[model samples]
Target: MAKKLSRRLQELQQKVEDRTYQPLDALSLLKETATAKFPESAEAHIRLGIDPKYTDQQLRTTVVLPKGTGQIVRVAVIARGEKVNEATNAGADLVGSEELINEIQNGRMDFDRLIATPDVMPQVARLGKLLGPRGLMPSPKGGTVTFDVAQAISEFKAGKLEFRADRTGIVHVMFGRASFSPEDLLVNLKALQETIDRNRPSGAKGRYWRTIYVSATMGPSIQVDVNGLRDTKLAA
Candidate 1:
């Protein structure tokens, strides 16, 4: 049976052509095609040429969105002593030491992003079964494990995002809200792309970026013309 699309989605889909578009054009189209009443996020889906089964082929890192994610990120910091105070003073939504870990283990998780100090990892590690599955585990690679709890908390609260390729080698990240100007979205997208490009796996062979698509939270995916997007004139 054919999957049914809503009338709004159907109409929105009509605005997207079958061919790939320039990055800026694709972003503009994504914003134009957003039909959600609430502010929808602009997302990018990149398919890379790599097998995650190989450790060296995995891509996991963080990117600071130039224009912000446009969504408030609730940050949780698990630290002790002065670090806990530092995190709280740095604007962390929730901060605590062992008690916070107990709360999480007991099924109380209210924050979107979780940061922890290096020394507390021994305690936080116990929650791996719960946090790992939710992508909330603090890893040094993700910039969530650090001594400067304040910097980590501030960066996350200021639109830092962690991304990793899934088992299938696809990375989906939110660039900004559909309501943002096309230029803003374009900047954020380019920043994310550059970061991903810089983090390409050394073990990966052949073409790296297989495909790139942009879409709004409730909009149709628009194929991005890779070559055209690389054009200095348009990308600039």
Candidate 2:
């Protein structure tokens, strides 16, 4: 009985590690799932938060998502000088203190999201009301609040995404919609997972990752129970 229970627990844990869902390669599993329209809520999207660990080379990772973020971003910044100019030149929608901070504070602005630099963080606290409730605030965990304004803005326009975990300690993210090709979805899914893994906290409970699942926009949530996810390395 003890052995049986241990095996069952191990099996369940493996599903959490099965972070990738490759449909083309696993047609048998695909047939078991009924297709549906993409979900409208970002709540079902999967995301991983990882620590950069002060590494310089991991600065940027460019990936062409098969399915986009499904939401539009109205980026705002608090930086000045070349950093400010650099963000606007790249086509960010908003770039000034009065325009960005003032509107966010009054709770009268309409924008999808935001990204800020080291110098700009002080301004964001004031706009907490406008951006906070809407889930548009630039957070430390999201990689939006950094000294590197150019990279932040560039990735924002390029669909660089930030995600937070829910009460269940799980993050749902869109790999792609049902209409997307398997390859595109695969690349994106892997990229997002890698970024999250890099952000995992060393001081997490028992094992920082308690659970994981994946679903397409407007699709059912499927837990990943694949080859290697079940076996994870502990932080040194």
Candidate 3:
């Protein structure tokens, strides 16, 4: 284990110095991970896709350095019925109303994230200028439009990050970074992985967690295999 650890460390150091690392082949990617769990020093970004157009089993996960995403999310919740208090108490930037329509008209709405209950969809639907192009508009795919406001707000507060797959079948998330010690990165990664594993949509039709790799901003990719991670992958 020590010998393997030393070799892996040298390889990583060389890669960092040379900066020539590329995406790892499936098996080797997970086998040669940089940490046991993930790093804590860095923030994480999550990507998720809930397509009304597609079935389950098609989700994919790939990691990038948090440094690359360059955005810290500010969450907002549009609440009505009984959800207003729950959302505010959970630390969300919140507003509640049928009159929210008028509030958005003045164009004061500004935030990185948006969530709404079923009751307020019409209000949000009317505010495309305030929430649309910015990707702050919440949707069912992003888990922000739902009957449960409290649950959604807490997820945001806990750094529940999200992303979506593009035309090329790749989804990108920033799971901490190298500036973070291996342990910091590890924890963030675990949080991300478990969240996905537990949230399998009841109707999901394809493979989940298709693939995962960890890389730094402008860094090479390291595929992380949960089971094989340990002495062999750790730095000596």
State TM-scores per candidate.
Answer: 0.96, 0.63, 0.55
User: Which digits, one per residue and each the tens of the lDDT, describe model 1 over residues 126-214?
Assistant: 99999999999999999999999888888888889999999999999998999999999988888888898899998899999899999
lDDT of each: 0.91, 0.53, 0.54
Candidate 3 versus the native: TM-score?
A: 0.55
Better of 1 and 2 by TM-score: 1
Best by TM-score: 1
Candidate 3 scores a C-alpha RMSD against the true structure in Å of 10.0
lDDT of 3 by residue, 1-236 (tens): 54343554556545443222222232233233444344322322223334424555345332232223224556777777567777777777756666655766677666666788877787678887666666567778677787787777666655555555544444565654445445545555555556566655555555544445555543345445434332123233
* lDDT by residue for model 2 (113-200), tens: 5777777677677767657766777777676777777777767666666665554345645444444454444455555556656655
How does residue 111 of candidate 2 score in lDDT? 49
Question: Cα RMSD to native, each candidate?
Answer: 1.4, 9.5, 10.0
Choose 2 or 3, whichever is better by TM-score: 2
Q: Over 4 Å off in model 1, which ranges?
A: 232-236
